[model samples]
Target chain A: MAKVYNFSAGPAVLPHEVLAQAQSEMLDWHGSGMSVMEMSHRGKEFMEIIHDAEHDLRELMHVPAGYKVLFLQGGASMQFSMVPLNLLGDKQSVDIVNTGHWSKLAVKEARRYCHVNVVASSEDRNFAYVPAEDTWQRDPNAAYLHYTSNETIGGLQFPFVPADQGVPLVCDMSSDFLSREVDVSKFGLIYAGAQKNIGPSGLVVLLVREDLLGRARADLPTMLNYQTHAAADSMYNTPATYPIYIAGLVFKWLKQLGGVKGMESRNAEKAGLLYHAIEASEGFYHTHIDAPFRSRMNVVFRLKDDALEESFLMEARKNGLIQLKGHRVVGGMRASIYNAMPIEGVKALANFMQDFARQHG
Target chain B: MAKVYNFSAGPAVLPHEVLAQAQSEMLDWHGSGMSVMEMSHRGKEFMEIIHDAEHDLRELMHVPAGYKVLFLQGGASMQFSMVPLNLLGDKQSVDIVNTGHWSKLAVKEARRYCHVNVVASSEDRNFAYVPAEDTWQRDPNAAYLHYTSNETIGGLQFPFVPADQGVPLVCDMSSDFLSREVDVSKFGLIYAGAQKNIGPSGLVVLLVREDLLGRARADLPTMLNYQTHAAADSMYNTPATYPIYIAGLVFKWLKQLGGVKGMESRNAEKAGLLYHAIEASEGFYHTHIDAPFRSRMNVVFRLKDDALEESFLMEARKNGLIQLKGHRVVGGMRASIYNAMPIEGVKALANFMQDFARQHG
Candidate 1:
């Protein structure tokens, strides 16, 4: 039972309190004589869990009125296709700001239904930086302007919000959702795969403008069609009940930690601790993105001596640190300091990096 | 301290032993210092769990080597679309047998990609029976023929497999996946949403013939593409890890119960006890479906006097039998005797039904 820090970037570390609560309730949830997994989606006990989760998420994010919060399955990948299927009905084109991997996925899925206009991109620079707002070429008649608020893979984030300009904005906020405060009304839709900030892997939280409902194609299957889910309160089909229950538990955990504002300060402190260590390492470590656009959630960096990277990861694993391996496209290391990642873990990682640099340099 | 029986169809009951095992392993799975949900999909611990679950499923079903098992998300509702998106890549038509609500949804989704021909339908009779095989006029050159093995809503089941004639039979076996043994080689493909007979709802298990891989439209995202899953061993994306871990626990439970054959005999006994009680109650307690095509898993019945149905359910709930209310589409009582349902629960339900029937008569 030696200590271990899991940093796998979703399916990532969850709050220990959530796990303890789940363990205690696994066999008999709230004395119902059924595990949460065994309860029907339509059951009153489970419905309360779903309702409270949505309400907590809304309160945490300051989600405005006339917005529907849908607890969906299939992660953000499903929403990439579903967004265009629902919102791109009749509109033959949409504008996209391709900052990194997730937005590229969004653009690709939209291509199946509409012409995806590349409004701006950092791909030419190997996606090292998020583009400035002025660089985006606006599409006045496009169905929606799509962007990723934070790119998990490339470790880039939009420092500036796109000017609404009366056109709807949609963000795939999968990685950095609820980490900081944002104006929910600024975006027509916001979707996040729960694995990152919310709770677990199977559930997705979708915040859609009320007007976006019923815009889906008639032939879209009930699950993928946004209207069916919104109308039924995300119960059109048998939901991933166990995952939803866990997400609800995570919501409770977040509330007890004083909600999103408290999280913002905590996250900033953790990210600062690691980033400062990288800056001090100087010639030993190299970061891709410049200071301003660099993500506070995932800090991707490479070693000056590229060959030392594998040994670095191996040594880190031996030190009881895990999943520090960077994305395949971006080589080196990525420390995703999500909310559940304690500041102590980052301090330990920073200490390890400092010692490792002294020995290797 | 009060015991209760759960009879909800989907997101339904799980074996108590499996939940207990999961509870004990919630924080640290097998000394890995991470819950299965917290592990990286590519990590050794999680991969071993996925591998064993798939291996156990293959063994339990006696699946041929030609078929690949996919543990997917988005439930059967997403399958309604993915099935067509993958299989209808080159075809203009497909045959569908509408036994109940689920098959109807499949046909509707397929219609978006191809012209769906209703080969045979029991909808005219409120889906109380599986239409006769002789009445079917399946398309010879269609991409595939689809049907629902067990209609959870209507409690109807196909007693005999359709004559495949090598045309590729695809069955949505969601409600009755591992309730009993069957020759897996008989069908070209099969999918089961893991709620009833399996573990949980988030994971959809697909057993597809190898040749069906790589037929989807090239533009489909990697996650939706079954070929991508097959090539990567269903680890293309972060999977529903917790559910899969629980499914492996369920697989172990089934093995402890002597596999599907033993489950079949036990299921038969339980179903018989309940159905025999209904039949012996004469006209007072009536069943909706015809005899031969009745589902062995979900027994759908009603009271002759419709008003008595309300009291039957209320009294049953107070007596520790819960979620017996039928699906909205089929308004009555449905006692879903899934794998987790014991013979004693069935006996209790039957005893309650018999006593209530005598009072009404």
Candidate 2:
């Protein structure tokens, strides 16, 4: 069977080369006589696998010396609570920007730990645009300023990082991480759920500046403490071994494609192709997100007639274009063109979109 | 190269057949045209995968209708805190039996959440035996009686379950779960890190009786609450998807081997083979653990002369007996023979043990 383009919002597409490599090494990893899944995290063989992965990721991201890159578990949602639990040392409040559903969830979880000040919101426009950084209200005395860098659900992304303003800048980059280059030193912390752009589910990559390591609340669970993880190099407990191994393969794949800069150009090209198709559908389709804030990772759009959406999805699946259905909250189509989604996949989706419009119009 | 016997502790051996199946389906799952790792957790495809996996697991374990099986992340180490945070409610204390290294770590974490009573311990004997249940101080007013069912490092397994005595029974079966038949109704909560007898690392399976839900402290993180996972059916957050999928395959594989009962008989046979070999070696090799309390999963033994240990390990490795080195704390040799380990592998290890002992006896 021919390979099909996968556009899942998360647990999304990964490089085929990486998948093949993983498959080939399923039983015995590098003649170690054990699957990567079967290796003890402390064993020399797995140690090399994880260390190389971290080194490659650090090199690819240009992570600074003072930052600790933690390969953690429980996904990025766990980080929503972990961030506040670890960062709010003596502070009673923190500032957050509400860009979309992901940020809304973060705000909700953060409220449980501290007084959450929603500094700015795109909620008034139904989360279609990212409020400019200059307009975001800052609380100078708050623990940190938090924001979602890319809203996977709303197809909105911030064009610029929020200025630090005497507070740490923490961003949830789950959807867009590694699809573009960012100045790692500019942010105090960055975390991404690996399922989207990295490798698979169960692993989260956390990059925290050295100084933020030991500030967690005393009452935090040992597993929830960033300092505990940093102290053990993220092996405070047996990590997600196989997922980390796969992420290493992904980091290798990313490097093969010339790292983050190379991914940025390809991602932009893929997003452009899909958005152009939506734009050319002359009154037949529409995208609710404001033009400038559109995401280069997730391209969301809706057909003029709501009744035609299901048929469009069914036809798309039949044509080997899958997972194009939009989030339930948005009720349309979302094409997530992550780094692994080749230009050929976008071309396939665009051609399907054009044909579907001609038939249904 | 021929497959070698894998004897490392957690993230240990998995069935070769399961690995092959996973490899063949790496790019597409059941014609879904997306890797299991690439499917959205909420999508029908992934929903089917998780649901089927859970159903098979339930059937294999004989989990009652009132029990919820949660496929969680962060491993059993995370559960050390989660158990207390979710179960303590108004109570400030719990009873813990210090069996070995795993239990010691649990007691350390539980101390952060609640008052832990070391009702009994085998630490004085280097964890070579399980303290008889009758010798344990009964804390009638404690929140629960927590114990490690198997200690991977010390190679000690409880010969019998601690009587519940009206309090909830919580067991950390991280190393020995699913390798033998366990009465599901005997405990209130059972958690296992899925790197040993289950599937892979990063995924922890929690089986909690329904009535125990909703007791978590108000200040606890939402992700740490058991009810939050129960309500979402373990999909509260994007779960360790690929690991859970692999766990599903493992459950299916278990069923093919006639469920846990089949595993029990095979495990006993394998353990008996190795133990017999050690006994046949007379004073040359010695098992520190007492006869009745030794773990069927982890066989830890040492050479009479400490100098012979290195040569024994080197020769064993040459003969394809890998990971035979004991844990650093134990400082000897250990062979972990989980359900995935065929009796033939155990026979090979036993043969190697005899040959090495004769060579240096």
> For this target, which candidate reaches the highest TM-score against the unseen true structure?
2
User: Evaluated with DockQ, which candidate comes out highest?
Assistant: 2
- For candidate 2, lDDT tens digit of each residue in A36-148? 99898898999999999999999999998999999999888899999999998889999999989999999999999889999999899899888877787888999999999
Q: Which stretches of candidate 1 lie over 4 Å from their true place?
A: A217-219, B217-223, B358-361
Cα RMSD to the true fold for all candidates? 2.0, 1.0
CAPRI class of candidate 2: medium
Error of 1 at B252 (Å): 2.0
- lDDT of candidate 1? 0.86
The residue pairs that clash in candidate 1, if any, are: B194-B200
Positional deviation of residue B202's Cα in model 1 after best superposition, in angstroms: 1.7
- Taken over the whole model, the C-alpha lDDT of each candidate is 0.86, 0.91
Error of 1 at A55 (Å): 0.9
- Per-residue lDDT tens digits of candidate 2, residues B225-290? 999999999988899999999999999999999999999999999999988998999888889898
